[model samples]
Target: MLHIPTWKRIVIWGLVVLGLVFALPNAFYSRVETHNDAIQTIEMQGSTPELVADRAAWPDWAPATLVNLGLDLRGGAHLLAEVQVSDVYADRMDGMWPDVRDALRGARDRVGTVRRTDAEPGTLSVRISRPEGMEEALRLVRALAVPVATLTGAGASDLVVSGAGDTITVQLSEAEKVATDTRTMRQSVEIIRRRVDEVGTREPTIQRQGTDRILIQVPGIGSAAELKDLIGTTAQLTFNPVVGRTSDANTRPEPRQKVLPSLDEPGQFYIVESTPVVTGEELTDAQPAFDQNGRPAVNFRFNPSGARKFGDYTAENIGSPFAIVLDDEVISAPVIQSHIPGGSGIITGNFNIEESTNLAVLLRAGALPAEMTFLEERTIGPELGQDSIDAGRIACLVAFGAVLVFMGLSYGLFGMFANIALLLNVGLLFGLLSVIGATLTLPGIAGIVLTIGMAVDANVLIFERIREELKTAKGPARAIELGYERALSAIVDANITTFIVATILFTLGSGPVRGFSITLGLGILTSVFTAIFVTRIIIVMWFERRRPKTIEV
Candidate 1:
């Protein structure tokens, strides 16, 4: 008997209804998108009259999840940036200066008057007044070398210390350089992602492309230049002891000090100690606020270790000027009035509210490990994306119409049932995509079109099997039952193999390829359900109602 249990029938129909409900939002994509954005803004910032009106664009009880459009479909910025990993080497050497100087000072009698000397980038050179002290100095510096952390770099030291005559040169070892490069790339990617996400862009792709390169695609941003401005700013903030203030642009600083121009006052420069008392890496939180003068400023808090260092530095250096350096420039040099023990400080400069807010976002996101040079940049226009969307819609409609015509002409009433199931299959696919917040690209559209054709494969096999059964003089219900029973193995085997391929594509591919694979994989699951279960239930209900003694194929 061709029959479905009461519970099974209800479950099948219930899922179909749920899928349609979820898919309904995508039909009104712009309205649902605006509604979702308005709600998110209200949650993040606060409710406003305009925002409230926008939120009411869609029904409050209705589903608000819409399939996110990919960069290609929505139009946005694309960039290929090459990270300057070598830039970190100089900073690394600068950081190690304090340790090296302390080690040499322990044997001050042996290594008389040690001084840091200028050298090439990535290399640190130290000269001693007495040539005889070089051997003792080398031993002291070599002691600071630690084992590399990576497994492949086992037993290898992080620093390569070498000496000749009165000078000692130290640079990162080969293994350490490789490890630093990897860490720098990873940090760059994470920081970039944070910066982009801070702006609340939808589905931005930030991934490492090669050894030192990154690929960024942010949808809804104005241009590539705008995107670059957001992530390219190093935002390296440091607090250093000021050596002196000068008006000469070409002024020379003593060893271990740098001359940086003022951010507010033109032609004014401040010479500050190279080593900072605290860096932005220790920042725990940052927010936009107003200063005592009611000017826009950024407020920041440091971690425990930073707080301790800052407290001690301020306590000892009372009445001395402290330079707040941002990206190699001094933003302000204010005298230490008291021991600021809480580690909370304010940064005030010539800034508007927007600038203050942006600075706060950057500080909270943390600084990039290294600077990035844009190798390629492009801005995709929304008009072009709309054209692509129109073309894709046309292609899908054509394919769908052709498939429907062929099926209806070939399989008669059975084909009509399959067509209905196919429609449900597409709705279910979109529903799953929305639930997962999947991004839809142009290639993803092709996957849906392909799925429309493949959804009828099982129905075709079963209908042909029924035609064969009819030749054996079987009744309508008996032939239909045998057809489905015989076709089950074939349907499962075919779909299983295709689904595995889709999984592989998704695992190995990126960008558009990934979008395609996601749709294809989800479509396979939905098509199988609709073709096997939905169509079968429809045929069973029709058989029970008519009780046909004999039927044409």
Candidate 2:
């Protein structure tokens, strides 16, 4: 007779029943649901299956958990970035009050008569008549205040400043460049991820490359072009005075715009370039609504400092028009009627429902810390993702079949019981996955097949030990108990190593790798329970019901 203690028998039975609870949630969901399945178009107002999952109205729930698909599985935009550490350092140096005050002193010394200058943070400005000795004075100032020592000090004048606006450019060394690049890329990744998340791009992957570069992948994104513009656009707005008559800039053939770029009210326009006087980092919130005439508009709120700068701009250029240029296209050019305060203002542009809503999202997300240049863009349609999924399932089926047939051939009647246990093991794993809401991937399916083999091996080891005991001519019950006690240590030791390896993979791997690790980890846990305890109880029950004259192999 085969023997199992009453408490031990209950424990094994309890595990089998527990698997049913894990699988029950499947009744509410489908394995392959279409877009129509997602929405109940004709759903009645009452409480029904159709009215469930109506959390769309909630912004926080816009990108809900249940539906996070991969990049290739869905279509979306991709982005690559190379952060400008030199630019960041230059901005910091130019903004220093000591540097700005010193540059002002040098300008007075060289020109003998100081003209107007705009000395903002991170930049020193000296607007003389483009003076005779202006070049030398700037050289002297750069050497004193903005030294090439802090940057890559190789330049024509030993100062790496651009003379485009009488600015010196300094180059950085290999070491300084590498460190700065890495820091900027990491910080930029965090900020960009937050912005994209707010915009509701599903499961966007933002990661850092070797040093200065970054990669972003988003799936199921409908507005790839708009997202591209938002990602790449330097949302830098500046206000500067019109040097000559306001109308002269507009007349210039090269810069073909109704209004020329100006700080003054009389001639103001927005310019799109890699640079910006004020970045969107200063903005806080944004909302969408219709203007007085029912035109689509966005209400954007800026930080206190940004609001003050904007207010001063409005007061100085009351009658002139300022262009709202995004990616160099003039969205609107509104004249300032009065100063804007309270840290918030509105923009009226000819926009539709979606565009206006997205603009608000972009503005609220603030500006990208630096421009990100795209290196690669790969799009995978849903048709291909579905095909891959189908193939993966077929592979799993084949693997399981092989494991089952081999186990039954080797173990005879005992192998048949092992096959049943393996089936239960797989059902329990998926049932737990579906209930816990883990997204299934191709690698995850592979983890299941791997679980099948391990489950069979556990049973075979125990049954083989029982056969060895029976050959000693002892009673059937004594052999069965000794078999379980002896094989338990070996089975646990093998599975423990695998569990630790899965844990390490989960910790270090990225994206899809993590999904496979998670499935393998969960599969390992479920396999141990069903294999050791459940199989023991079933075999014991068989012998208790009817003891065999000759034990099956």
Candidate 3:
């Protein structure tokens, strides 16, 4: 009646051994963590003697994975940034100016001379000198509108063009604005992730908080300001043909050009073409270097299409000054002395080495789709995290010791069996955690403590059931079998209900709450296995070896 098949025996013991093996690395936490970091560094930056030595200290066959600590455990900076999604609308309108002007100019005979008027940043206002041709002017502008390819904005045009008397006003349609905002937010998240990853930090959390906000938590960072400096820069670089240089702010630029102030010379301005020949979007690589004058500079290389376009522009426009504009300010307007074929150039300014290096980093990471305004920022200290870890460790030990004593005093030998199973259950929990690389927080530690108390409850139920069966004059084997059989339904029902609750917590919660749910869920699984299978195996083997005719529960 108490017999276990050879296969089941092997499976149960095999799982126990695997759990202990996987859990062993946590005992040597610092050493194993160093080894893991060394391996990753070697893989990323090639192997050095120090890295090789550290990696060699840990065997390859052993589990190298460790639980990733959260921002609270590791010292880090956290930031909540809201992307200015409306910024893209202004840019879209600015870019469409040339197209609108060209289309209106084609119908000059009917619409008279077209002049752009003052309007909001996201709107284009043009005055058609002849009011009779307003319908044709509106038609020409609407021809440029494209369909918004988004779920909510399907089959909608990108722009809404309206006319009032002789004036035409154009702005982004509501559907198109929604589509653009969604795209901008998604691209912002991806670029932020790349920027943080390029800095070589371990396990940074870059997630979207809502429609327009992003939550960034990077552990081991010095301060939130440092992270903001790394990611906040737009770094929008463009090369526009210089229309002319002047000191007058009132000078009207050409229809397809604009005037921008020089960064190096405050009063001087450069009138440049609004359309760029090439932008930073084409850049494939950027690195910090020194110019011929030994000044800190950033060197950039373009991709194939960008290289070809740049080469053609330089070849045809040799001796013409081209302005390098960054963030709407003129950095330099250097004259092209020769045809540059390779699509590589250097940007030099009054930059120190650090500024040049940071510029290079931003270029390599690509530009954000929109500007970000920081809403919240904070730095978590390592000392506070250490205190939390210390408190959690003490609580765990206290709960564990208390449960062991309580179980031992209540069920005697069977209690000792349950204690061994409980120890293995905890080991299995850690083993699963390490394998999945889950983050352990203070709440997670509390979940494990709760699990310890729950783990013993099963053994108490079984022992009491066995005692009840013994009172009915049943043999030790039959009483144990009946006890396990009777208790199986209760154990399954209770644990299943608790597991569902844990799942709901994980789905609905964030951060520390989710961490607690993870440990609670894992604990439920391990405790159930240890209680129903592991403890039974130990009891069956003991009873068979002792050949007891009657036993005290």
Q: What digit string (tens of lDDT, one per residue) describes model 3 on residues 1-553? A: 8999999999999999998898899888878877977877775446889998898878888887677667877778999999999999987887788799999999999999998877988998999999999999999999999999987888899999999999999999999998898889888998888888876666788889879999999987889999998888888889999989999988898776899999889899999988788888899999989999999899999999889989999999999999989889998889999999999999988888777876887888788878999999999988878887888888889999999999889888988999999999999999999888888877888888899878877778888888888887468899999998898888889989999999999999987888899999999999999999999999999998998987876
lDDT of 2 by residue, 267-332 (tens): 444432223323456778778888988877887777888788777777777786655545444555
Worst 10 residues of 2 by lDDT: 56-65
Off by over 4 Å in 3: 43-57, 105-118, 126-132, 147-156, 164-167, 202-212, 237-272, 277-365
Query: Which residue segments of model 1 deviate by more than 4 Å?
Result: 41-48, 247-250, 264-268, 289-296, 337-343, 349-351, 470-474
Q: Measured by TM-score, how close is model 2 to the native structure?
A: 0.66
Question: Of 1 and 3, which scores higher on TM-score?
Answer: 1
TM-scores across all candidates?
Answer: 0.92, 0.66, 0.81
The whole-model lDDT of each prediction reads 0.91, 0.62, 0.89
Best by TM-score: 1
For model 1, residues 387-478, the per-residue Cα lDDT tens digits are: 88898899888988888898899998888988899889989999999999999999999898888878889889988998988777457788
Worst 10 residues of 1 by lDDT: 37-46
Candidate 2 ranges with C-alpha deviation above 4 Å: 1-180, 191-205, 216-278, 289-296, 303-325, 329-342, 381-384, 412-417, 431-445, 468-482, 506-516, 533-553
